[model samples]
Target: MRRMLTVCAAVAVAGTVVAAPAMAVAGGEAAGSGAAPWMVTVAFKGDEPLVQRESCGGALIAPDRVATAAHCLDHVDPTHLEVHVGGGTLSEDPGKVVPIKGWSVEPGFRLIPSPVDPQDFEKSSAADDVAVIKLARSVFGVPTLPVARTAPAPGSTVDLFGHGLTQAPDPKNPAAALGDQLKHAQLKVLDDGACAAGLASPGLLDGKSVLCTQGAATVCPGDSGGPLVQNGRLVGIVSFGGETAGKQCGEPTVDGFADAAVARSFLTQPRPPLAPMAAADPVITGTKAAGDTLTCEAPKWTIKPEKTEYAWYYNKVDPANGFEFYLPVEGATTPTLKVTDELAGHKLNCGITASTAGGTILQYSDVF
Candidate 1:
């Protein structure tokens, strides 16, 4: 049996609503004066008519790359996917129409099985849902947005922009349709536990790879593949939404997003290498006078080490002796070594060992 998955698109069908949120970029207003320039309206190019068919929303992350939802273009041909940027609305003419030269989908994304269980729907939607489209030629004049490497903390607010419907469909009037104006909404990031609880699914939300938003505003149909901006950075892509009991848009419990950090590898070219760890030797601090406490100061490192060890030793025989011997101080595993009366005339020192992924570094402090 085919399983059903809920996707956040504007298209409507009979029996089931394709699992997308409701119309009018529901609960949002016109993006207005401060609209993002990187916003783009995605559509299909037909053979019969050279017209651009608007489908979803996307953000330009590079001169020739756009980031969107995997589900938006999963079934469509890459050559037919057209990207229109610097537009006020889908109905109005955008600055330029760029043809997609190539595209890539998150490797882990999979189709939801038909007749899917309600409990498992969220898990299916939360999986890799990101995609990147490379344009046929480099786009100039329009500024590209940067992708955020980390997700915003829960309770943080984000702005969503799309060319989806401006109002929810009237249930009584089944003929009501979505709008073509670019709209935007402010939504708060919900805690993973809270989002999962609201959806009645446990362990279904992955905080690192998925973002859940809850509030009066959310993405609706035609809003799929839109950009979720936090601090002016592209942190997520609109993916799916949970339906209400009425099976209509508006007042959704939570809307889902494909995390941009998880999709970073696909959006950028020539990925940078990881830096090596630089660790310094430990130093001895505090008064070294007899009967006073002498402390071993751990060295500062460029990268934090996983583990650290400290060892204290004291000279047990006179240095004048050709065979002077040093012995480990019992119960002195810590960084602090107390100078007792018995060790009044003995030389004391500390040895430090720091371990990291690169390798282990060992150093010793001067005798006190």
Candidate 2:
């Protein structure tokens, strides 16, 4: 239940930031470059291709998209953000480094208290800490990891990857022990409900959006945003972890992960590069009667559209506001729509969306 802020090597007290007392990856061993080729470091812009300023860890979901914890993006200047790829250790020679083009934090993300006071640890929990980072260009060579559509079942074993301290750093010089090489460990998924209940913080590990896990191997500072892989697919992002009874690093503890399954839509939703402009509005043709089929003609676009999507909507008068508003017809997406009895007295309209490398644009047809 320790609300361990795994990303920063410091904790925030009241309104001030202070150095952390400990940060280490106990029971973790060195990870080979092949062990996690898709792994990357969310680091600051530096002179070297692979900088040692590891802020957090992340995995490439697509050539140009990385999945990480939203907290890693907090308060950090976007200009200083960049991704380091193809290196097993931070000091390794030449690797591809890409600047961050953009990023999206999943909605409803909450920041958990760092180094939560033992008395308040059980009550300190956060939600939706996942984020997707857009790289300036696609990374080549390294295979991207696919995101799991669901969380692994309890008792399932998973792999964790990160570049964090392997042992507790000397309090006098914490950064001296910061690990230079990537490390990994095996962990077991725990019953989220039972885990949360033990910590007296059910909302922290709800089993829906947050997953509960534990093992002899524990994540430490610089591990936040790292991937939790189950069956070669990413299932969670390192969110938070803490030892039992306020013990220091390396002790047994339960960790909470931002479930990738719950954030699949946010992670996989298309981000079109540009929008296609319609030369003309869409046109609907057909008899306006029940049982009659209607067709929507798409307008020409400035550029060839890669894809055209269609949708149908019906208008109904609101009794309270006396205003007519459009509601989408369930499961309607084809260019042709059926005028079913369900919409006998309603005014109907169809719309077409044109998607291209330039962008995505939508145009509505005349009411029918």
Candidate 3:
């Protein structure tokens, strides 16, 4: 998938449109049956500017971040990536330009393209197929979309937005245009029968987990790394396309695309790994309820945040093979855990000790 060719390419690929808006071709998974009214405009570093109309594009994932296909950044440098919002057109009033500060894709990305073989058809061809961009400054004048935690289950609907390979009033060669404005398109999920509609180009779809949709979200020479949103959450990045060879934008073989979990795995350094809870001195914030569920609470979680492992001990022992507590509990996610403590009519003492790849954040709770 080449970035300048209406898809993802460098350091590499990755948006959507909106009256509400529509975009096409990205992760091949289904989204919910709703429309995400958002999209973004991008500019390549050292390029003339957004004035060209098709320098780049992306999908909004946060107030200041846009998820994109890493391949699109190839040839170009991050220093040149800029976003524009408000009033819809890429044209600006000088003050409307929003520059990108810092961002990251998976560290395992490859700056080059992957080749296709007639024998085996798999999607894992290139090392660098996806990427993300963080705005250098907080964007104003535009509404952004949210990111989802996982891919939408099968059978859901997906929405897209971008400048597709729309022809000018007069027909011309596909490569004739130096600057092309992105177009908007919508694709409804097709059944298994339609998934394999056009497989002429081996570079596009490899058959597995493909999405079949009607209409054209096809090759737009410049729509890459756009956001695939569902339930108001961004779940996928436009990394690949299913257009025919020499075509600008093509219909997507896969209607929807995304597995949020897969993209998250690319984080070379994840928020330093969420600090896990260590067993604390026992605390029953509330007593057992009539439903036979005991209310349990843990002490405030405190971890210095270093390379380490965590262990919660109950009665001086790791409960449930170092998992479910040996004591009663309630439901909470942090150090002050609150899971229903099924252990009743038993006295318990709990505490924790955390270990890291570097060392351990040590704290022994009192034996309660």
**What overall lDDT goes with each candidate model?**
0.64, 0.69, 0.42
State the lDDT of candidate 2 residue by residue for 1-368, as single tens digits.
Answer: 31223322222122112223333344445676588889878777676434346778889999989888877764333445678775576776325688766566676676544343535644355678777787879998889999999889999898888775544456665555565667777788888666776453444455557887777676665677889999999999987765323434444567778999998888887883323445567888888789999889876654456888889999999899999999999999999888888786888999876654433445787788
lDDT of 3: 0.42
Q: After superposition, how far is residue 54 of candidate 2 from its true place, in Å?
A: 0.8
Candidate 3 wrong stretches, greater than 4 Å: 5-38, 45-53, 92-95, 110-128, 140-142, 168-182, 189-214, 243-258, 265-368
Candidate 1: list runs displaced more than 4 Å.
Answer: 1-27, 46-52, 111-124, 168-176, 243-246, 270-368
TM-scores, all candidates, are 0.61, 0.63, 0.50
The candidate that wins on lDDT is 2
Better of 2 and 3 by TM-score: 2
Clashing residue pairs, backbone N/CA/C < 3 A, model 2: 274-358, 274-359, 275-358, 275-359, 275-360
Give the best candidate by TM-score: 2
> 87-198 in candidate 1: lDDT tens per residue?
7755454647886655655666654421235444333454677777777698998889899988878999888887654435556642343444566778888888877676
Candidate 2 Cα errors over 4 Å, as ranges: 1-26, 46-52, 112-123, 198-203, 243-247, 272-368
